[model samples]
Target: MPQPGATSRILVTGGAGFIGSHFVRSLFSGAYPGLAGSRVTVLDKLTYAGNPANLDPVRDQPGFAFVEGDITDAGLVDSLLADHDAVVHFAAESHVDRSITGAADFVVTNVVGTQTLLDAAHRREIGPFVHVSTDEVYGSIAEGSWPETDPLAPNSPYSASKASSDLIALAYHRTHGLDVRVTRCSNNYGPYQFPEKVIPLFITNLLDGGKVPLYGDGLNIRDWLHVDDHCQGIALVLEKGRAGEVYNIGGGTEITNKELTDRLLSACGATWDSVDYVEDRKGHDRRYSVDWRKINAELGYEPRHDFESGLAETVAWYRDNRAWWEPLKQRAGLA
Candidate 1:
């Protein structure tokens, strides 16, 4: 796999999602080394989470372009891969609760859609199809952090679908020698996140004098990575990551749901007086922590923001830009 040098033509799938959209901004803003003036074409399906506002910052940038489409569409994928040199795939069915209610869409969007992208990349001779995965694929961890070599034991339909896609990406690399890289990232919270997730849910509920719904005693633990840090890691992989390798992106912030919600309430200037404990969802993982030694040593990557600072910045952004997420909340039936 060739190192993605400065200004390489790249295709980013799902560039409209919370994480993917951040990745697109990083590209145009030149957040990573050797990426200035790089051309990025985002192929998105415009799912509920895909908002054009996410790409508002990059629409007119000289190196940025977007196409509203699904990755599973073989014809469109082939045509795009034929033009770009590298791919950063972030498109998938990501919400665990949605996946629990119905796994069918997750199966189609993650497994089949990734396969379509791989096939197109192979046919078009595209290099470095960076398949984005999730830490949930490794299941629950008690004390130790999960490494890239950890055996996958995904517990939720969302994680299972992502694991399935990661395997397909690796298979394409070994079987056909296509340059494919994989990244498994932990929980992400920042601006532009869909309100269905924990952060936005609690923030909006508090703002509206609604009860903060807590699931399953709120003990589920997850590492929270700022979207910008996640984007930086993805850019590093796209630019210098070794082929057929899996890098873990993490925030190094370990907190349980209960504790996290507490912080969120404080950020919103609310108290625990208005909380609702909801029935725990089935198969919720106990914890997730990424061992970033691989990407750290290889790419010299470390998260730029600490938890407190990042969370404060995140809270401030949401507070300042309620207009950006208010429509999403209403559309999702949260408002």
Candidate 2:
């Protein structure tokens, strides 16, 4: 395993996106004790969801570099892997709504792009290639949470592609002896997030005095995870996780969509009047919950952020950072 130190050079794919950017910022800010002083190279394609301004905080930090490129490009991926000791992959076509409208992009980026990166890492003899994934790959659970060993039952194209990538990532470890670690996390929300996801979307909309959409009966349940906590778990997996293993990282806070909307409305000083009950997303999973005991037992990982405070902070961030998210919303036609 490659140890985290000053000499460590880590390649972070999708480092300009929401969750990935959080991880990159943490690495540079001494937030991850094990990875302190490690050099980081951010590889981002500057997609619609990726904003270069997201890395502005650490843009000029020592031992930090940014590359604008595609992960599916073998030449670029191969060249970047040559100089890096390890890779933390977060690149993907992640929005389920987008995937439902078009599946090709999801397959290309999530599945093929991952395979390309894995192949390059394998060729370069890289150690500890951490694959960041989602609990959605396990599909919906009616009651109990999903463990690391549970069978994958992804529902949407977005999740199916992620599930495919997860399997291929593990196959590299099993078949080629490449050191690979996988982490599946629940829903993430935090600052610098593009205003497309539910939390950010509703927050921005409510901030603008617009109506928020409540899909179906607003009864769908999801476990909310703060992006900081998610990144912490990924850092743990990157540092000490066993090769060929899957870890489930969760926030342990589960609530119905109706409940979440109520909270967002309260946070934004709005009421149920601003809500629009819409059709539920096609093939939407009723509830998602992950049993994160495995990661906790092995890595001493536990979420430190309180959901109430975290949600409040997230709302405050969007409310106060209109200059950051307004342009993004306008460009995406959400404004």
Q: For each predicted model, how many residue pairs clash, with residues at least 3 apart or on different chains?
A: 0, 0
lDDT of 1 at 200: 80
Stretches off by above 4 angstroms in model 1 are: none
Per-residue lDDT of 1-335 in model 1, one digit per residue for the tens? 44477747889999998999988887777677587767899999999989988999889998788999999999999999888888999999899999999999999999999999999989888897899999999999998999999999999998999999999999998999999989998999888899899888888778777888898889989899998888899888887898889999998999999999889889889988978899998898988998998999999889988888888887888788889888998998888
Q: What does candidate 2's lDDT look like per residue over 1-335, in tens digits? A: 46666689999999999999999988888898888888899999999999999999999999999999999999999999999998999999999999999999999999999999999999999988999999999999999999989999999999999999999999999999999999999999889888999999999999999999999998899999999999999999988889889999999999999999999999999999999999889999999999999999999999999999999999999989999999999999999
Residue 266 in candidate 2, Cα distance off native in Å:
0.7
- TM-score of each model, in listed order: 0.98, 0.99
Model 1 RMSD to the real structure? 1.1
Which residue pairs clash within candidate 2?
A: none
- Name the weakest run of 10 consecutive residues (lDDT summed) in model 1: 1-10
Q: After superposition, how far is residue 254 of candidate 2 from its true place, in Å?
A: 0.2
Clashing pairs in 1: none
lDDT score for residue 228 of model 2: 98
